[model samples]
Target: MEVVSEDIPVVIAFTPNYFVPVATCISSVLRNADEDARFHFICLLTEALPEHMQQLLNELVGELGRFTFMDLTGTLSADIYVDPKYTIAASYRLLLPDLLPQYDKVLYIDCDMIFRNDLSELYHRVDLDDNYMAGVFEATLEQQLAHMQVIGCAPGTYINSGLLLMNLKKLREDGMVAKFLEAATQEGLEFPDQDVINQLCKGRIIGLPPFWNSIRTFLLPQYKADFLRFYTEQDWQTVQRKGNVHYTGPKPWKTFTVAFDLWWRYYFKLPKPMQALLIIPTKLSLLAKIYQTFLGKTILDGTRALYRKLKRNEG
Candidate 1:
């Protein structure tokens, strides 16, 4: 193993269709990083990333540190049950211990988020010596009961897998890959890899404040009561001050919200022409909202059903 260096190794996994948000995510990090921050990015993908995108990534990370891309096509087991909403790319983070043996620890974040402050604090300050990984709690104790039962984890320990400070050395020593594979084969796993991680690393996960991976819903009046009960007052202040926003439910390009506005603030940093192309989803979402408001979901569902039936008949 190489000597543990000060440079942070940050990992992200995404598909081709998510390039816009990927770029935006990276941009937020590069732009907001502290002056002394140094990073090494490892992007995992299943398909061959286009050269232009690779070049753009290089340009984005220029002089900051290295930006490496690994195509992980066919890397996951065929038997691993991937949820319909997620692709095989979702499991690519599981390969980190093997793929990045040189690094003792690494930060893995989803591409659907943007940083509000320098990540140096997270990469340097968090102690993962005794734990396999550290992450923020994803739900209230009541809400986590079902997931905890599914994964056999204790209450308040179930974490959102979106942002993680992974102790790769510990995971490698524990042979986590095999354990993950075994858990992947288990029945009644709703969250696929997330369940596997929680089940395998139970009682070993260090819980961070929710600010680090603040979902937009936490800011809503309906959820804030539960959010406050689940987390500390400092956590709420940290999120309010400056923390990365995770677009867990609705993406910014497809909907408008305080969190989406934060996303747009960073996204607009890209060239004007490309920005135009990215807002198409927002336009379509607006149109859908208008259609639903006037005609209702019943009409929309019936229309979709009729369209699908017609297509099937034509086929």
Candidate 2:
């Protein structure tokens, strides 16, 4: 397929362990995209893919859209501290402007999400003339303020980095990469890459609608009050319509959640072999938990109850 200038450029980063999640993410996007829509995917890798995984990825890329594998080794300096919890690949998004100068715009999406509708609307809808990038605001003002303090950005300027519509030309013109690198090296942030992006592009980051990046935090009971306080009923309705559900914590493949079923629906759509390889672990894990619960209730607890009942009858 000839990649036209109008084709949207998407970038996703992952380590070797994340191949399955990234595959599911790409599959979900293609499934929902318009028939003629084109996407040029840039896969930033912390390590090279295994041969089998590479073959699977190649097949998927060949069938759906164009892709390029970017090796991230030796590219970023060690002074940039990536938290042990997150892979170094998370920081690769900062390199996009310098890496893809041919494109005026690019979209960065986390691998831990699934698209519910065509992304062409999001790509074409958000205006990026004056903004460095467009992203959904953090869930609460307090969280946003905390991030703002870490990055020295103004309140409400902080955004979740899971989904971003980047203005690559403008960022490149401003030498944002150098600035981001300086800030990242100087400061140890709670969310390193995201904070650096917010700090460097503070006033220039526009807040898009929440539906574009529906974070899992909003659905948790602890955050429900904050969710309601920040968003209106209409906003919630919009999320239901076309929101890209981001599995920010406890991925569906590892554990079951309200969204796990949705993730599996897309997983099942994959070729049978791929499905078997990926789904078995999740299914077995769930079954193991169920079996443990059954044993505790029927074997251990049941014997204890029986002993208690006999003692009461003797009394």
Candidate 3:
């Protein structure tokens, strides 16, 4: 392979239940990255990964880069709030500064996403300055403003923590790790770790373009106004070409979800022998095309109703 880029350290955190998703995530990165791009993945696990899975991950990387797993089974505090859709391991990202003391900068990506292009540009080009971390803003600011304000974060600055360009050196120097853990465990903090980061890192966080974390919510036709309210036409156009699809709610694995086929392509590329571990039920595949149309429409209708209700209460 030709070498043209510097080594970029990427961090990902997951639990035993997310092994297949993590595998797909890694596969996408390796498959889509530039031929010259080099990466070293440091994955944080909530428990000891099975030996066979570890070997499979190693094989997945092959000569493209390195894959290292850090088992953190007993280190986390149990009090952190965990959403029903996610596992307790989601909060593990807060420990990155302490966990990887060697790197001043690292890219943290959630396992539920897939890359459309090489990450070298995003990794090497972002300027963090004195900020603790940088990430794309979550879409639909109007609907989310009240909730953001309740958490003490400025409406426009609240970002989705899924994809982050972290300045570990600054985070460590400012003692943000301890602060993050403390805030994560606090009661009534919606989104747990994400709320803590926004609440505490206010004024010190950087917001990147939407393509880095393009959530499924952006595609809802009912939210056209909301989408334009937060991002420019140019931003939307760019995302269409290069967005790293984030499967936020209703993951492709378990439900009929938009962009499921994009994810399926990457999973299908994984070693044929190991592909069986990640197969979806035959019923889901057979019915996916039939329900694809209504699934999105239903979600939009429900979201519109909720938006109207929120507007009435605010009025």
The best-first sequence of candidates by lDDT reads: 3, 1, 2
Which number leads on TM-score? 3
Q: Residues 228-295, candidate 2, lDDT per residue (tens digit)?
A: 66677677767756678899888877865535556766775676656655545756455434434546
The alpha-carbon deviation from the true structure for residue 122 of candidate 3, after best TM-score superposition, in angstroms, is: 1.0
What lDDT score goes with residue 56 in model 3?
A: 87
Q: Evaluate residue 304 in candidate 3 and report its C-alpha lDDT on the 0 to 100 scale.
A: 61
Clashes of 2: 0
lDDT value for model 3: 0.80
Q: Which residue pairs collide, candidate 3? A: none
Using lDDT as the measure, which candidate wins? 3
- Tens-place lDDT digits, model 3, residues 68-174: 78888878877777767567777888998998887889999999998897787888888998998899877645667788778877656787888999999999999
**lDDT (0-100) at residue 60 of candidate 2?**
75
CA-RMSD of model 3: 5.4
For model 1, the superposed segments whose C-alpha errors exceed 4 Å read 1-6, 141-144, 272-315
lDDT of candidates 1 onward, in order: 0.78, 0.77, 0.80
lDDT of 1 at 212: 86
* Reference-based lDDT, residue 89, model 1: 86
Give all TM-scores, in the order shown.
0.84, 0.84, 0.87
